[model samples]
Target: MAKGYWITFYRSISDPGALAAYAKLAGPAITANGGRFLARGTAAKAYEQGIAQRATVTEFDSLEQAIAAHESAAYQEALKALGSACERDVRIVEGLG
Candidate 1:
C-alpha cells in the first residue's frame, strides 16, 4: 500500500498553549479522516546548525487521502484555530510502499 506523509515546518512557538489547543482538534480530525502521526517534536538539530523550526509528520494510507484530510472541513477548522498561533510550512509526500 502507498502511504502518505505530511511534513510540517514551524517557526519557534510563542504560545505553546495555543498549539496544544490546535493539536487537540487536529489529532481527532486526522484520525477521523484516516491518518495518524508519524513523528512530532521540536527541531533538535537547531541547537547545532540553526534549524528551521519544529515539525510534525502525519501519515495516511495514500497521498490522495492525506490531501483530502487537509482539505476536510474539520481539519480546516483546526487550521483556522491554529492560524494565529504559529507560522507553518507544510507539504504532503507520497511514501514508497
Candidate 2:
C-alpha cells in the first residue's frame, strides 16, 4: 500500500506559546494514531516562488490513518488550544510504497 504523508506549511505564527501548547497535545495524539514526524521546523531554503516558512512532514501507515489522526478527538483538542494562533496549509498525499 502507498504511504500517507501529512504536510503542513506555516505561513505565519502570531503566538508561539499557543503553538507550543498545541504541540504538547498533538504529538501524542498523532503518535497514537500511527503518525511519525519526519521533519518539522522552519525551511532551511526556499526555491522558485516559495518563501521560507515553518513546515512539518509526517508519515503515516496509510491514508486513512493520516486522516483519522487529524480528525481524532485528541487532535481536535489540540486545535482548540491552537485557536487562531497561526495560518497554515495542510495537505494529505499518498506516496509510493
Instruction: Please write out the lDDT profile of model 1 over residues 1-97, one tens digit for every residue.
Output: 7899988888667787888888999889999999888778877676554465778899899999999999999998888777678877789999998
Residue 38's C-alpha lDDT in candidate 2? 99
Candidate 1 wrongly placed segments (more than 4 Å): 47-52
Provide the lDDT at 50 for model 1: 49
Q: List the candidates' TM-scores in order.
A: 0.84, 0.95
Candidate 2 displacement at residue 55 in angstroms:
0.4
41-81 per-residue lDDT for model 2 (tens digits): 99999889666989999999899889999999999999999
Question: In terms of lDDT, which candidate is strongest?
Answer: 2
TM-score, predicted candidate 2 vs. hidden true structure: 0.95
Error of 1 at 55 (Å): 1.0
- Segments of candidate 2 deviating more than 4 angstroms: none
lDDT of 2 at 70: 96
Clashing pairs in 2: none
